[model samples]
Target: MTESKAPGAQSSYEARKPQTRGRTRENTPLRHNFWVDLKELIAIPDVASRLKPPPKTNKRLGLRKTAWCVFHQVVGHNIRNCLALGFQLDELVRGNFLKDYLQEPQGALTTAAPTEDQGHEVPIHGEINTIAGGFSGGCTVSQRKKYAKGVMIVETQGLDLTLEPDLVFTKTNLRDVVSHDNDPVVISMVTTGRKVHHILMDQGSSTDVMFWLTFNKLQLSLDQVRPYVGCLYDFAGYQVEVRGNIQLCTTFTSDAASRTANIKYLVINAPSAYNILLDRPALNRIRAVASSRHMKMKLPSLEGIVIPMKSNQKDSKRCYENSLKTKRGVCSVTIQPPGED
Candidate 1:
């Protein structure tokens, strides 16, 4: 066999950032997520023992079913589609074998700002155009008429929707988040290479919104704000004035996997507790599913991996408390010094 079939020593594996997203162009054979994560999680001696065996329902009855299950070692259901497996996985994710995969946004990788051509957007540099609260002032007649005409549909051109990963919600996801039944899902997101706190996942919103104070805090260039044509409504259906809109990439992360999506946010010149509000459109664009009850968000990452992230319970309480202050005309924001970020 000479040197063909024999290896004196193997080179150590180096984990590198993806050179190109899909169909990697680099000559390197291994991928960033090349390791079989499930297998690794299961390989742990403690984890392998902690996992309960598959139920009797997973056992194949005859030769008709071809969906093979790893847990049952049968053909009743596909391994990925197995509910028992997903449940156990989510359970283990909380504080067991899968804990290694759970991580905060601070540990995740963040990409730079988009280089795509931003349309000719007339940026407004002024601080506050309306009241601090979003619903305080209504929109103008012209804005109302424009909004009445048509709905603005954000185009999805650069989004990578190649893989469809399984998203599941069970008792495991609701473990610690549903105690008070008053927790609002608040999670930090990496936007423009910065960890932005108090990001609210508001599914009721038709479009994403960014507060003017938050926009300024991020130190984002005013040139990125595009003119938003339509008007936005408040809780009473009264049109609320919007400052402008900007498209920024926000990363949704879970344990060791993360996914980035370009989100078009309508910047509102209102002071509020929340820095940004992720709307239904943004969720759909990211292919994300949020469970307010569980206070968790899960998205499909590249290579069909399910990325799961949890909300900050303390931050959620803080945001809501601040929101209550805003409702009572007593809102306050901590001012950062010149040297601080």
Candidate 2:
């Protein structure tokens, strides 16, 4: 505060050194390697104090108890908290509600009451009466309740239950009765070398003949077959091709006499729907009769009908024409005498 001097006034008596230009190597500061040493120091435990425990409060609870309380409260707790506590609300509600729901009244769902027929069972001691008109020899009868469907039950004695059809039967063995009027028949075919049970027959088919399945089963090659186009009708009214030709050996015998007949058959592309058809041509060839009443065919000379190993084209043509006529919906077929044609 004593008489202030001006801002730039200074003394000139101090020593003056020469001014240096740019940076110089001699004036640089030194750096220490203490960082590596500091890391080593931190590795040692503190020599003074021990670790302390965390704070505790009455409001804090175990995870399971917290979840249980939160679930029971249902107000402040949310699904996330319930999941964290491992609590399932839906399962708990279902278990408790199911017991209560089942204990309620019986007609809660309004379901219909079951009728007697709905739970009907066949009686052990039920009486069986044969129906009046039946194709077979025997049928069983069971009385139907008023409200039940008009179903009659037929029973046959001494017959195996397992062999019977599921439907009620008015008669058993109707082939005998049906043959009296319609002349029932059965026709079967077997290739030359194969076994004899390969008979194929279909009542619904218009023609009875051999099929490729039997041909293949017989181990006969296609080259051995002669191609022939012939007509046949199936159950569905579709026309099928009689592909190749075959010859069967049949033996026919009657009480009076016995003879062998060589029968030729046309091959047809028969699907599994109809494997082999015993048409009128095959029936007329063997002079066979089918009885619808007894479900059997009678061949008086069945043993004498002989099918040869080789077939002739002329004989095959005659068989095909007969089968065609049979397939055309003709009711009956009778072979004309050999000299007539």
C-alpha local distance difference test of each model:
0.59, 0.35
Runs of candidate 1 exceeding 4 Å displacement: 1-162, 236-241, 328-341
- Give the Å error, residue 153, model 1: 16
Which residue segments of model 2 deviate by more than 4 Å? 1-191, 196-206, 230-242, 251-260, 273-275, 302-341
What lDDT tens digits, residue by residue, belong to model 1 across residues 113-139? 222111101122334532222211213
Using Cα atoms with residue i matched to residue i, what is each candidate's TM-score against the true structure? 0.49, 0.30
Residue 118 displacement in candidate 2 (angstroms): 42
Q: Which number leads on lDDT?
A: 1
